[model samples]
Target: MIRRHMFMSALAATVALSGCGGGDKSTATPTPTATPTPTPTASPTYTAFPLAAAAEFNTYSAAISYTGDPATSAVTLGAASTETLSTRVRLATDTAVATGTYVMRENTEESRFCVPTGQTCTSTLVTPSAVGNPEFVFRTNDATTAGKFSQVEYLNNVVKDTSSNVPALVLNRVSYASWWRGDSTAGQKRLAYTAWGYSTVYTDMPATGTVNYSTLTVTGRLVSTVGTTTAINKVTGTVTMATNFATGVVDMTLTLSTIPTGGGAPVAYGTFTAQGAIPVGQNQWTGSFVTGSPLSGTLAGGFFGSQAEQVGTVFSATGTFGGAQQRLIGVVVGKK
Candidate 1:
């Protein structure tokens, strides 16, 4: 009887412990692992190349953004939406471009404006100094020149062949849009002009041989032009050239971005690629964007510097954005 009583008491104790949650495991809502936020890559730095005497800029490609209908007097500027005009220009000045009076000459003609050095000018519709030539007025609103107007801003040691003691203008040139008035064969009309890429007068080029080349990563701004409006953002990417000069094959990959005007992190715009071939004994090459790219565009570029030490490209791209089609154009340049 005593043994039976002891067994009953032990069983009761076990039951009691179980009912009171002793040795019982409870399920918990586990904390979730947090997703980490990504950090943005910083924009690359660049140096501006000031204008020098005998410095020349041979335009490779350009885009014209203007206001109003170009055919009427109400139009302040006519847009050249489809045409790409090449202009070779130079300044005849020995002083700093920021404060120097320059005799700007384009090709064999002189398009004259009597504005002070680095100052913006707004004048009544004036006649072109040369009968058939267009006259340009420095009217850009760039703050870098202290709110003064400048035709060009060269950056990133962009001009090569400096060892020759001559600083010829070349790639990585950012030429702001300027105002112009011309008496075309049709009639008098106003216009705004902007150049994308430029190169120095090539006194020499690479020779044909078993040549080795390195990959060049170029950086610049991607400009977007929609009718009369213009928007610009920072861009950077890689451009691969042929291992040998005999092939002359070139390929490029780039990413565009949307930079916040209020100074914050830049948002990614898009990535694009292009491929082309350079002609023998020529500095320029042309190609198209790869098939199935997120954007459709055309690419053109050229070799810059005395020994082809630098390269540059000008591109035009179009894509759908914010439920509307947008066109983008830009210039990128890099060194060997």
Candidate 2:
């Protein structure tokens, strides 16, 4: 009944007994191994923790410009040589954010060369989480004037107020100028303008007897010099101060304006007026300008928050604009 070559010989003997019982074998594809390349690391440098001196906790200044033209060389501030300075910043941190080396110390003991007592001033700030306006570079290496070096251009607008105890008024703006290289005799080149302001903490003032007579109103920004022409005029607007504190005085005004070097619009400088006196328990004050035509200069400042609301100032003056002889300097801040 089954007889077709023995039924194909039983199907070839069941496929040779299923290939001798160990079937399923067909593998040949493997050769991929090459991934080894990674090496690059070097970027870290820090050294900025050393600053001490506390009062209202930070703010110091020195001014003595108006002596130039006898040069042995050196003395060039802004526009040509007008010199300006201003500051009233308060940044505090022990550990929340504020990494090393950003200091501005001043203790001229009486030698005063713009920080020179064994020399060591530092500034390398740009990391409070960095966002906007955070520039600093206040260097000093004039161990006593040899090649004579001193630099400062610190600008600040920092505002990190994580629920305050009051220490975030940061409005710093400085650009320094100093000179006295041993001979220029306007009394040896007296252009000594020094400044210092920094803090870690220590603020509490406003209670000399608690006499709040009130009047206060302030505003800021001015940066001068235009008419004896070296052209360095920033003078935008707003000075409008008016502190009375019950006749301790302080009366300021300066409509102010500028902008025109070929740029169209903005011109109308000075309404100027100044007067000062406030010292008994002192919060600071000192003035002179009386009118304004470069009438001559002098103005000092003080008072900030905790019921004084805010106010900071600085000034220096000169005369004759467009007639050939002018000079100026400024700094201001305001509120209430």
Candidate 3:
């Protein structure tokens, strides 16, 4: 998540602007106002790990938390703070995966994570084609805390769809859990614990036009759990990808048919519409949308993988349901 310190900094800037230009101008040489020193903002710190020998690809998921206040000193997933990093890391070489490093820096732009643009972070990778579960640790450097660390675990697997002989990554899971000591006098507290699973199999859109505009049709089971009750419904949707291959820009629109409520009255959930973007060669797309007509609530999340491959596509979303504002989290796995 984006640190709350950004809001604080914006507030400080507003105050500074409001106080300026009202002071009397002296006839003597005016002393230039000294620039205020910028306060340090919390960012994610990562520890590099060597890749396994037989690992060709991997997926990672991580979460972080801090003690005391989150404004000045906080921890978060890098770059895509709103969404956890659940990316597939492709190895570059036949050698063992080399150690890669990342350092926390001040936040500047809303989208980019580190400050001063390109000089903010660096990474090194060595490739191999093996798979196994591994764990990593990261240390934090901030004004209010020391010795804070974040841990991540990865579970890897390969799955082949019965429809196609091509094997794709599937059923991979990552767990992020951390504990940190905020104050010197206090004990460490559990910071965060979250798990995410994904599959490489995705709904593929058929080639349509000159630019290769495509539409993907997916039919799957949607399972949702709220409190102690669970519901399952058949889901059908089509995703249209408008792609500009030259610029590597792609936008997607999703339309879902009505879903069953599984209630005694047998009321059906309303249709839903969502929009998302697919970055260049990245395997994930994320966006948000609102429910239509009789249903009211906003939903946000993303789909993993691309349309070119017939790999299983894993989707996850979190939002509220119905007028009662019931919290809902849903996951859909579509495989041919």
Candidate 4:
């Protein structure tokens, strides 16, 4: 009995020790859990205006009319006159203020009013629509005029002229290269083609008469820069227009002179002719041209403003150069 009691006591002690974990020399270290990586949040997308190409400024012309009162509040249909205004605005961004110049003409009068004759104006662009059009407002102040206001809606290259008392005036966006032609200052003239090159060919057709086959001269420059090298080459060409008022169709032909080499080794530039057509009432024209042997590509463009205007007429052209598929775009204004 004594032996059995001793054995039982020893077994109970061993059980207690084992249950108390007394036999282990050291506790096992716990395995560390890894921190989970967080998922990244997406950035919000913003709507922006649709621009054809990158440009520093956007320029527009507006025709305004005073309806309620020119002096007090007299409304009229025909613009007591019209105005062409330009401001610096970003192509796809909202701008708080854009300031520029305006040349205004009074109806039934030859007199003209110009801002910066000691006057100032401002404009702002609002949020763009889902379709990418932007709404804008323009205001100006002067001693002669107070509370002058204009609202505009832009769609593609066209702007709705809400400032007019009559039917909303429609304004077209002008290319920077074309708009540069109106700068008469010598400094401006020197840098006219600095931004981009242009070649313009223009001729006026009589309002009512047989079309004249005049040799419309095309003059300007082809400018390009690669790295630190800039090239400016004189562009000389001729254009002829055939208008059939009865059919309301106008046809054009373009012939370029020998393209000079500049900026680098002479590009094997080839001479090509293009034929394009436009409706009598439309200003835009488009066509394709094929170059001769050695080099081959296409040329296309559209004109701004009425062909009847002696000046302020703008043209934009885009074409490919060389067999390597280099592209070029340019704008030109009318001389005569």
- Choose the strongest candidate by lDDT: 1
Clashing pairs in 4: 67-75, 68-73, 68-74, 69-73, 69-74, 80-107
Query: For this target, which candidate reaches the highest TM-score against the unseen true structure?
Result: 1
Please give, for residues 232-267, the per-residue lDDT of candidate 3 as tens digits. Answer: 444445555454434444343445543565534323
| lDDT accuracy of residue 149 in candidate 1 | 31
Can you write out model 4's per-residue Cα lDDT over 1-336, one digit (the tens) per residue?
Answer: 999999999999999999888996888899999999999754332222133233233222212111222232222222211112223211221211222232222122211112232344333333322323222322222233343333222222222222122111122322222111111211111111111111112333333543433524343344333333334454555566554434544444445543565344333333444444544544333443444422222222333333332112222233334322222222222222
lDDT of 2 by residue, 1-336 (tens): 569989799988888877676464766589989988887543232122122221222443434343333233222332212222233322222221233233333333122112222344232222232334332333444454454433333323322332112122233321211222233232222323332232111133343332422232122222333333245344445566666665667777756666665677778766778778766566566777785444467766666434454555566666666554445555555445
Task: Candidate 3: list runs displaced more than 4 Å.
Answer: 1-57, 60-236, 247-249, 257-268, 278-285, 290-321, 326-336
Q: What is the lDDT of residue 247 in candidate 4?
A: 51
Can you rank all candidates by lDDT, best first? 1, 2, 4, 3
The TM-scores, one per candidate, come to 0.50, 0.26, 0.30, 0.30
- Locate the minimum summed-lDDT window of 10 residues in model 4: 187-196
Q: For candidate 2, give the lDDT of residue 83.
A: 21
* Model 1 pairs whose backbones collide: none
- 10 residues in a row with least lDDT, candidate 3: 104-113
